[model samples]
Target: LHHLKTKRTEVYQDSSPFMSYSGCCCVLLPYSKCCYVLLPYSYRCYVLLTYSYLCYVLLSYSYRCYVLLSYSHFCYVLLSYSDCCY
Candidate 1:
């Protein structure tokens, strides 16, 4: 019984971080009977992951827009400062 308890603790410790990070508890415990404790958290974490991914995409787009705007501003300043004879 003590050995089983220790083994279970080791499994929980090993899987907990991965489950929490990716909602992939099923992947870890596929052959195990069922994950009553981890399933609900997995679903919730999946939703959170989706939202976080969307936020990441939006942030990337915003950064791109800022870069383009800065580049255009730099071009405008350069044009204003220069007196090309062409």
Candidate 2:
């Protein structure tokens, strides 16, 4: 049980950045369901969507980063892609 709890916490921490970027209230439901309640519409939503999409692209491409510095470089690529696309 303790291990499950720790894993859950890790999952939440991993997703916290997306939640912060979306600027929406969200609830994690049973069976891995997530419901997001959007606040007043704004440009932030678009930016969040773009960022999330880029993250998906990077993950799909299997971009490997062995060090912390490589993660920073991955973020730089994300920013450049977002700037060009958006």
Candidate 3:
């Protein structure tokens, strides 16, 4: 709980206890079902969430670039590559 609280504080800029608990589960729980068979449930959730979150952030950034640089298709390609390959 303490660790999740701190992580929530750092990542989300919110220190509320409720936010900590909810954030922990929101950040971890969904992957539980899909990745459960891959690694220990907890570790797998952590890894999957981290990867998916980072990938999402990058893909969003690339999409923004695509919109801004619509004159070039490269950004769209990059977005597709990130979504498909990451």
TM-score of each: 0.15, 0.17, 0.12
Candidate order by decreasing lDDT: 2, 3, 1
How close to the true structure is residue 54 of candidate 3, measured as C-alpha lDDT? 21
38 Cα displacement, candidate 2 (Å): 1.2
Q: Which lDDT values do the candidates have, in the order given?
A: 0.20, 0.24, 0.22
Clashes of each: 0, 0, 0
Pick the winner on TM-score between candidates 1 and 2.
Answer: 2
Better structure of 1 and 2 per lDDT: 2
TM value for model 2: 0.17
- Which tens-of-lDDT digit does each residue in 2-86 have in candidate 3? 1121123233324422222212222223223211111123321122223222222222232221111122333222222211111
Scored by lDDT, the top model is 2
TM-score of 3: 0.12
* Order of the predicted models by TM-score, top scorer first: 2, 1, 3
**Regions of candidate 2 where Cα sits further than 4 Å from its true position:** 1-18, 22-31, 41-86
Candidate 2, clashing residue pairs? none
On a 0 to 100 scale, what is the lDDT of residue 85 in model 1?
10
For model 1, the stretches where C-alpha displacement exceeds 4 angstroms are 1-21, 28-31, 36-86
lDDT of 2 by residue, 31-61 (tens): 4322222224442221122332322222212
